[model samples]
Target: MNLDELDAALRREFTGAEAERRVVVRQAGDLADTEKAETDRGVPLTVDEIVDNLSDAPDEGVASRWNWWMGALEAAYGGYEPFQVRRIPKE
Candidate 1:
């Protein structure tokens, strides 16, 4: 699913607490590239810094957001492809 669809699904399927946590996790995952860039530059990154960077990043395209959400979901749930998703609880 695309990012907008995924966001809507998360809102629908998750309670307030779970939705908040999902946002945190997704934001963290989104910072992966920025974190790598910082590491390459020999700069240390605090959690807040990473989070802020992620928050400021562009989310203009459905395709980019889809990839981001898929990667985050895969890392959290252990696979990107739906067929590879085990008997985990839907989130």
Candidate 2:
């Protein structure tokens, strides 16, 4: 799914597996090359540092948004632009 779709799912879906995995933003290029540095201060967006951090824990009114990145044994981010994602067996 596209990042936007993943984002919507992250916000609305509850798989009851918060402890399994988490997600972080990743650069398809060097982190220093983009404006994503701003998310370091805690914001959320894509391709721009202005809003690049994951959403702060989703509140009770926001569904599972917070659970998307709060607890996990592992976290992953896209390694390419228009960041496409598919799941495959982990080696």
Candidate 3:
């Protein structure tokens, strides 16, 4: 599905508090990598990697649960094509 539709689904499935928490978890992971790269500068993590990390974050609400559900839907409808809800680059 399109980004707007995915966003709407997230909102409909998640409570406001849960959404905020998810954002915090994702941002924290991204920021951690940025901090690490400041010193090493060897391999800056890609946006896709950061988003993939977030997908593994502990489920906090229906929004997170729906993420898995959407994956299943996409797999069935899109012929097993990967569906990433977060706006991250694809390799």
Candidate 4:
């Protein structure tokens, strides 16, 4: 999905924090761009896949869930650390 669609999807799943939501969407876009550049190396990222991956995370917030997933990817792939949601804007 495009960035707009990804933003809406994130809003649906993670409500209340606008800044954090935007951060997640931005990070997702970055991931998509990175994946697109290396299409042959990894699975293409989609809104559904992102949501599904974070759905079972042990965290309660969107940023937390996203970070959890990013951490997993970093542990397995080694480059996803930069995409991790480092700070959540106070809301």
Best by lDDT: 4
Best-to-worst ranking by TM-score: 4, 1, 3, 2
Question: In model 4, what are the clashing residue pairs, if there are any?
Answer: none
- lDDT string, candidate 1, 1-91, tens digits: 1334435543443334444545534543454434543454365544444333334435533233334544554575544534221222337
- Local distance difference test scores for all models: 0.41, 0.31, 0.42, 0.79
State the lDDT of candidate 2 residue by residue for 1-91, as single tens digits: 1444443444344332322212322222233344243244343333232122234444432223322332220243332222211222243
- Global CA lDDT of candidate 4, please? 0.79
Residue 68, candidate 3: C-alpha displacement in angstroms: 0.8
Off by over 4 Å in 1: 1-38, 59-89
lDDT (Cα, 0-100) at 9 in candidate 4:
85
How displaced is residue 59 in candidate 1, in Å? 5.0
- RMSD of model 2, in Å? 12.5
Which residue pairs of candidate 3 clash?
none
lDDT of 4 by residue, 1-91 (tens): 5888877887887643888888988998887876742463366688888888888798578888898888887776678888888887787
Score every model by TM-score.
0.28, 0.19, 0.26, 0.84
Which tens-of-lDDT digit does each residue in 1-91 have in candidate 3? 1334334444554444545434433533443444543243354444433344435646655335435544553555542122233542322
Q: Cα deviation of 28 in candidate 1 (Å)?
A: 5.0
